[model samples]
Target: ATASLASQGTANIWSCASCHGDKGEGTQTVPRLAGLAPAYLAKQLHDFSKGTRISDSMAYVAKSLSETQITELANYYGAMSSPSGAQPALKGDLARGEKLALSGDYSKNVPACFTCHGTSGIGVGAQFPGLAAQQPAYIAHQLAMWAGGARHNSPLGLMAGIGKALSDEDRRAVADYLASL
Candidate 1:
């Protein structure tokens, strides 16, 4: 039933595959849904529905989903496994990104990405979604949102503080590096 909904949207909604690939790979800035933590996905949907996260399309779709539908969709996407192959178009400094991912610059008050995101940005738990193979554009966009306080659902507002601390170049570098992994 959820698969049907994912593939064929109701009269009022758009199909998930329209923007997210048929395999949930997702296009630039759309976000890959496959293999994500179900709880994380569900939280995002709830955030969108509540307007805590800012995305016009996501808000519309999430608001239309019933609680059961949200759970089903989250589980369906979480069960899917896909290869990571996001190409970087951001032209960020890979070396800097690697350094930031592994060792943050204390001068900037930024914690290492891996501190919460896991060693390789594979995610730590339900709170931190995997960054591996995510679209660089999406990652950059989210960082910007967090920095601007447009999205603030993160735990203890940690992401927002980190986002504000990172320079534009740092954000791009880390985003590109993570996508390449």
Candidate 2:
């Protein structure tokens, strides 16, 4: 259903490939689309449409699309193979990351990463993202954005709160571990 509409062609605002590139390799600013999971792609589209992600470029591009079109676009990009991403690195210590991801700081009463991210960093209900294979740079950027209230895509507004709870060392640890995964 999504494929039929997406590949049919571009719309008035912008063709899906305009920024993502013909094959979804993404530009310097735009992120790669091809090879991304359909689930992740759908969440991003929904976030942009709902004003949660709040990117002027993305919102502008998204405005012309219908809800069905959004789903189709997301599905189109998500279904791609040969996803573009950097190789994971594991230099930072992971003990703290393990604590945050698995049990959190029980003494600090911090919540487990699995509460929102699921057991394997694969995300869960709603629009949470899968963290398994993302690049460390992107992960740190996203986390910082959440902590600073810069990213509005988080529906529950929990990212800022959660991000604030983490120390810099913890963030690095998690990013490193995520790359390793």
Candidate 3:
């Protein structure tokens, strides 16, 4: 499993490490997979393969894997320790971002991200994902995708509505703040 995850095969499949890094630390556009819930990871792989999530690269790679492989990969990454060294990818108002993340704008029906994502944004089981130390570019891109209806994998359109309610500046702020965590 380590070999497969670290090296690409001859069958046109890109190794997970090629993009996500050996320890699943991820890059500017990619997201860290290490320490994610096994269930969440498996669901994402399934979603990518089924088009419930939209990502050309992920979809293609996920489509090539069997269910067993997906589960194995998920388990492997889920049990691994999260790596450090994430950096911010955007500039924004940190104070405003903190307010949004902790209290939100109730007038706009925006719930605090921490309400569902946990106090530190380390995620809530398989339901919400960890936002701490993630790539700001990845976070901002996902928000944009949800806002534009290009991504709809979040349960009950939760993220879609939240994304739509956030202004471009808000998105950047939140992304930057989360990366700081």
Alpha-carbon local distance difference test for all models? 0.91, 0.66, 0.86
Which RMSD does model 1 reach against the true structure? 0.8
lDDT string, candidate 1, 85-165, tens digits = 687769989999998899988999988899999879998779988998899999999999999988989988989988999
Measured by TM-score, how close is model 1 to the native structure? 0.98
lDDT of 3 by residue, 1-181 (tens): 6457545543667899888998888898899888888899999999898887899999998998888888888888899888855776688788878888999989878899999999889999888988888888888899999999888899988999999999999998988888888
The Cα error of candidate 2 at residue 74, in Å, is 1.9
**Candidate maximizing lDDT:** 1
Assess every candidate by TM-score.
Answer: 0.98, 0.69, 0.95
In the predicted model 2, the residue pairs found to clash are 35-80
List candidate 3 stretches off by more than 4 Å: none
Pick by TM-score: 1 or 2, better one: 1
Judged by whole-model lDDT over C-alpha atoms, candidate 2 comes out at 0.66
lDDT winner between candidates 2 and 3 = 3
Stretches of candidate 2 off by over 4 Å are 1-40, 81-85, 89-91
- Candidate 1's C-alpha runs over 4 A off are none
